[model samples]
Target: MLTAVGVPAVVLLAAGADAQRPVEKPAAAVVAEAPPCCMELVAPAPAAFSAGSAAGGRIEWVASSRASVREARALPAGVAPEQGLQVKTILVARAVSAIFPEIQSIGGVRPDALRWHPDGLAIDVMIPNPGTAEGIALGNQIVAFALKNADRFALQDCIWRGIYFTPGGARAGGYGHYDHVHITTKGGGYPTGGEVYYR
Candidate 1:
């Protein structure tokens, strides 16, 4: 994991000024600031597994009850939220965007009162022509990535093609979510804060 740090300014004195007076110049240091809401670029996480199978790419549980460890507001730096996702969800969106260029939009924060959507902790990774073979393949890859990096993104659950994936493993049944991959973070519906990491 990468950490952000600040630089210090430097002071230089001119040689041979006056006997009592000297010229001093200060050089300011430049520091890169992370965007508001703990937004930072992250390298792709190391793969936990190579394939997506019941026995191949099972997600290991490494989740947090609270998504953010520090106080943050608004979305990540470049992530565009569909509805109104929480900070942690936006971080996941940003990670997906960085990893998968084919993905265009992500849906967040809905009116569903019974689930994580309305709380802004869930996201729908929209897929184009999801019924097609290519689309399914891409969704599977994404699901596999999510499962592998469950700890990095603080993921709680991932659902694709009506199949649910947790750190425990994958299970099938139910309906809907065929057009997009649904993912939820650790937080329940409530105000979220803190930093989010991609890897």
Candidate 2:
């Protein structure tokens, strides 16, 4: 009824065999676990092509193509294709990081999704917490920056801009962007631009 640190060879062999048994998920649950790939990354798009960009620097749909619309790239800041991470995306990320160091290190202001927004520019800036003061401030900054540089960044859609959260409804500088903020510019849907759905 007792097993010592050093067990008989036979007992140890049996125990080891039992340990090797593999565990499997329930058939029904297993199917649900691996969901199909609904979203995918595409090539970078141009600023002039998409419509996700807003008017006068407001955020809007990514493109006329409903499919592409969702895949719009939220611009970060500058444009550099060679770098794995786009320059614009990195710039915007850096901007937010500077304003809020805590969140940035913990992973905030990075796009939940990013690509060619099809509105005008490319890359989507995804704000992780689209509902907090920090999130709001970040969102506001994105909108303001795009607007200020309308001529340069091409200022695509700022969909996460007008989101309005109650005094404490969510907690954001913009509207219901607490969940996640989407900042699209112009670029490929594939490979992504790092933008989260804010509203």
Candidate 3:
């Protein structure tokens, strides 16, 4: 009787040990179940700017002066040809010109030797008497238009009178942007540290 009881006890102990042992899973199966840590997902590019979707009104390209083009070409290296009064810049300038026909002067794609310019993504529209009530109102209207229709133009940011607006919101800080509204596009690529107007 004692031997039989001891045998049963040993069998139960063996069963418990087997239950505690971890089962080995196939390496391939384990890997198949886990997602890669560095997996990359591609996103589609944003819609291209079109006349039908342009803000303010229809876009019309304004010819750039030979001097302007020459100056842009002479800018420092790494600046692409498009960055200097090219297609993208012309598009933006034309759009604004259509919206504000009263705007006598518009500047686009001027290479800044001291600061970074968005290759083909930036334009400057001069505000008439920027310090006065009318000028501020016009600036506000333009800023509002840009912010409201940012997707239409692929605008990344706009700066006016020391204030800058991104899709996120508005902040204050910029140099020599008081008289003109400065607009930048995401398509031109981001600015380097030195290119940023606001610290």
Candidate 4:
């Protein structure tokens, strides 16, 4: 049974409950208008993606589950912690942060010489407790989410846990992607609103 918390807006789902809800126009509007909240509800991306180990010479793609969060709820707006990021980049960063509250720090527009960061096209989602098992799992989920929503976000690539993921496929051995997930997006105009979604 679904139990109501002190706030009507907050409902704690039972363990293992499939919290996925049908996408509604009102929910989309809420996501667009709601102020960024770290405790916003998020649904794990359904379906799986192909992945391969970095050690292999020929990448043998295998199916990997994308769902990670325990339950689903309406997606809320997100905040951009770092500055100097593109408008599209900011929107995506906000979406990611709202989807994953564990991610507290997001780095953007750094002086990486000629890299994507210097061009304000990249954002780093730093993983908390990166050495722990939970951290690894979170990183995996974030990567999966990014890959799943690549076209919607105009994502170029996502690197995490030594693996590089694109809309097409994923390959391991991405250097320096241990503690954080790196996401790069193609150039795009500012979002008019309701561009991000959990489903």
Best by TM-score: 4
Give per-residue CA lDDT, model 3, range 14-79, as digits (tens): 111111211223322211121111101121333233534233232222112211110001111121
Best-first order by lDDT: 4, 1, 3, 2
After the best TM-score superposition of candidate 4, give how far the Cα of residue 9 lies from its true spot, in angstroms. Answer: 27
Query: Highest lDDT among the candidates is held by which one?
Result: 4
- The lDDT of each candidate is 0.54, 0.34, 0.45, 0.56
- TM-scores of all models? 0.56, 0.31, 0.49, 0.56
Over 4 Å off, model 1: 1-79, 82-84, 188-199
Between candidates 1 and 2, the lDDT winner: 1
TM-score of 4: 0.56
Q: Taking the tens digit of each residue's C-alpha lDDT, what string does model 2 give over 126-190?
A: 56566666565555554544443333323344445444322122222544434444444333232
Mind giving the per-residue lDDT tens digits that candidate 1 earns over 100-160? 6688878777788566888778888898889987787667766766665566567898888
- Candidate 4 C-alpha error for residue 191, in Å: 8.3
